[model samples]
Target: MPTQILKEQLAISIRMLERANHIDFNGHMSTRVPETDFILINSAAVSRSTITADDVIMIDLEGNVIEGNGRPPNELPLHTQIYKRRKDVQSIAHTHPRWSTMFTIANIPLRPVVMQGAVLGEIPVFPKSQSISQQEIAEDLAEKLAGHHIILLKAHGAVVTGTTIEEAFVRSVFLEENAYRQYMASQLEYAHSLEDEDIQKTKNVVWQPNNIRKIWDYHFSKL
Candidate 1:
C-alpha cells in the first residue's frame, strides 16, 4: 500500500522464497507503486537471503532505475513488460523451483493434484530457453503469459503474477508444491488429476483474497 511497506514485503518475500528454495541467485520479485509509473523490485546482485528494504530499488516501466543504489536485474523486462501489458497484475515473481523446472523438460503437464493445487489449475509452459534480458524476448514472454497467473519457462524457471506480491509469492509456493506432488505422483505406476468438478470446488475457496492473505500470513510467519 505504501512504498516503504512494498520494499519491506519485497525483501521479506525474496528471503522467504530463497529459503523455500524457490529462488536462487537468479530469481527476483517486483511490485507496482500505486499511483505512479514506477515499480519496486529487488536488485540483481544481492543475495536472496540477506536482502533488506534498502536493497529494493525503484525503476520506471521502461526499466530505468529511478531510486536506490542497487543495480537493476538483467531480466528486468520480465517484470517491466508484464506490468505494461497486464494492467491487472500488481506484482510478479520469477522463481526457478526444482520440481517445476523438471516438468518443463518432460512431457507431463502440471495439474491440480493436491488440495491447494486447484488454485493454480494447469500451469502453462512458455517455450523460451534464453534469458529474458531484452525487450523483444520479454515481450514474447509476456504474450505467452496472457490471461494466466503462472507460466513456466521452457527450460529455465517459472513466472507468477498477482494483484499483490503476497498472491504472487503464495502462488509461487503453490506452483512448486503442486509440481512436487505432480512429480511424486509420476514416480508411481499411475496418477490422476482432480476432476473439473473437484477443481471447481476449491478454485473459489482458494482464490479468495482473504484466503490468499491467510496463506501469505502463514508463509510470512515462517519468514
Candidate 2:
C-alpha cells in the first residue's frame, strides 16, 4: 500500500478505536511502512480521536523520527521492539479500554466466552505495572507476548498485533467487547465459555478477509 494511504488508514483506525471507547487520551497505534523497517504512528500528545493523517509520524526501527512533526508516542519502543521481534506483525494497537484494563488490574483471566473471544484463546497478561518506555522493558513485553496476537499490560493497558491495520483494529475492538461481556457475566450466578471445538469452528470464518473488511467498513463509516 502507498504511504499516504497507510497514514490515512492509521488515522481512521485511531478515530474508530476512540469512537468504540477502546482508547481515550492515552492510546497509540502504528503500522509498518510496507517492506521497510520504518513505521507510521500517532504523536505522543495527540488525542486518538483528533488524530489526522498529517499528525502521524514515521520512525525507523531504532526509534528515530524520519518524517512528520511532533514527538512520537512515549511507548515508541513498545511498537518498535515488537516489530523487531515479530516478523509477522505489520500493525499494532496499544489502548486502555475500561473493561480490559479492569481485568488487567484485577489480574483476572480472559476466557473465550463469546464467538469473537475465540480468536483470543488465552490472552497473556504482562505482570509488570510500569510504563514500557525503555527498550529493555519493551523487549521483555515482546518476550511475554510470545506467539500471541494480544497481551494485557497489568494495570496499564492492552496491546493487539495483526498483519494489517484492519486486523489489529478489529481484534482490539473484539478484545474489549469480550472483556465487557466477561465483566457482565461475572455479575451473574454462573457463566459458561465456548468449548474448544466451537471456538475452532468459528475462528477461521470470523477472521476471514471479507468478515474483517465488513467490520473495518462499519467502524470506518462511524468516523
Candidate 3:
C-alpha cells in the first residue's frame, strides 16, 4: 500500500479502536516509515472516535510538525523516543486499556495467565515522571523500554510497538485481554495460573511476528 493510504487507514483504525473501546480520550497512536524519521500521529483534544484521516498529523523524529494542522498528542515524545530507540519499529500504539491500567496502578508486571498473555521477555514499568517536556519523557521512556515491546507507565497506561499499525493494535488488544483475565482470575480465589513451563512455551510461540501475522491480517482486514 502507498504511504498515504496506509496513513489514512491507520487513522481510521485509531478511530475505530477508540469507538470500539480499545482506546479512550487519553491515549495516542503513531506510525512511521521504515527509513525516515517522519511519523503520523493522533493529535490532542480531538476525540479519537471523531478523527478523520486528515486529522492524523505528521512530525519529524524531533517532534516538529511537518504536516497537518492539529497539535500532536502530549505524548508525542513517547512515540518519537520509541522510533529512535528501536529502528525495527514502524508503529507505536499507546492506550489506556482498562485492564492494563488496572495492573499499572497496582504496580503489577503482568504474568502470563494464558498463551497470549505471556510476554516473551520482561515488561518493565517506568516511574511516574509524567513529564510533559519533550526531552525528559523521551529519555525516561528510552530507559524504561530497554528490553521489550510492551512497557507500562506507572499509574498511566501501556505502550506497544510493531512493524505496522495493525500489528501494534492487535498486540495492544490481546495485552488488555490478558490483563483483564488475570485480574478476574485473581478474584476467583482458586483460578489456576499457567505453569512456568507453559508460560515459557507460550512465550516462545507468541513472540514472533510471523506467528501473529495471520491473526493480524484477519482482524485488520475487517476494518
Candidate 4:
C-alpha cells in the first residue's frame, strides 16, 4: 500500500484535473512508487469528482492489485507499459481534454504555442482510437510514446507522463490550453508555433520549481 501522503497527492491530482476540466468520467492517474515495482493508481470505478485517498489502489507492474478496494482502470496497460519502458517517468495521467482530442481527430499537429507548452515537446498520436486494454496494443503504444512527454490517441484521449505528479497535472492542463489557442489562431490563418530559440529559452523558466509549485498550489487552493 502507498503512504498516506501518496494517496492524498493522487487524490488531490484527480480533483485538480477535474477542476481544470481535463477529465470528467473516464480519466485516470497513477504514480510509480520510488525504488519499487509497485504503483498507486486511482480506481476506475471511483468518481473523479468525489475521489478520496481510500479510493486509490496499489498494483504491481503486472497489474495485480496489491492493496485497496475497487479495480484499476481498464486501460491499466496504458500506464503499466509506459512505466516499464520509461525509467524517467514517475507519474502518468490519462485525460480526454476536448481541444487536445480535436487536434488528433483533425490530424492537426499540436505544436507548442504558449510558453508553458514548451515543456510538452513534440507529442505523437497513437494510431488507434479504441480502448488500450490489451497488452500488445499497450506495448506498441508505449514504444511509440517512449521518447515523448504526451501522446494523443486518435479520436480518443491523451496520455501524459511526467517526472512528478505535479508536472503531469500541469502538462495535461496546458495541452488543452495550447490546443485551444492553436485552434482559434488557425481560424485567422497564422497560428505560428513557438520558435525553437523561444521554446529553448522559455522552458528554462516554465519548468522552474517555484512556477510548478505555483500551478500545483493554485489548483489545490481551489479545492
Residue 80 Cα positional deviation in candidate 2, in Å, after optimal superposition: 0.8
Q: Which candidate is the best by lDDT?
A: 4
Q: Distance from true position, residue 11, model 4, in Å?
A: 0.6
1-223: candidate 4 lDDT, tens digit per residue:
3477888899999998998888998899999888889999999899898899999999999999999998999999989999999999999999989999998888989989888778888899998999999999999999999789999999999999999888899888788889999999999997889999899789987888899889899889999
Ten-residue stretch with the least lDDT total in model 4:
1-10
Steric clashes per prediction = 0, 0, 0, 0
Q: Return whichever of 2 and 3 wins on lDDT.
A: 2
Candidate 3 lDDT tens digits, 45-149: 677877777778888988888988878887778888778888878888887777877777887668767777775346788777374347777778876787688
Arrange candidates, best lDDT first: 4, 2, 1, 3
Worst 10 residues of 1 by lDDT: 183-192
RMSD of each: 1.2, 1.0, 2.6, 1.3
Residue by residue across 167-201, what tens digits does model 2's lDDT show? 99999988988888988988985457888788988
lDDT of 2: 0.90
Clashing pairs in 3: none
Off by over 4 Å in 1: none
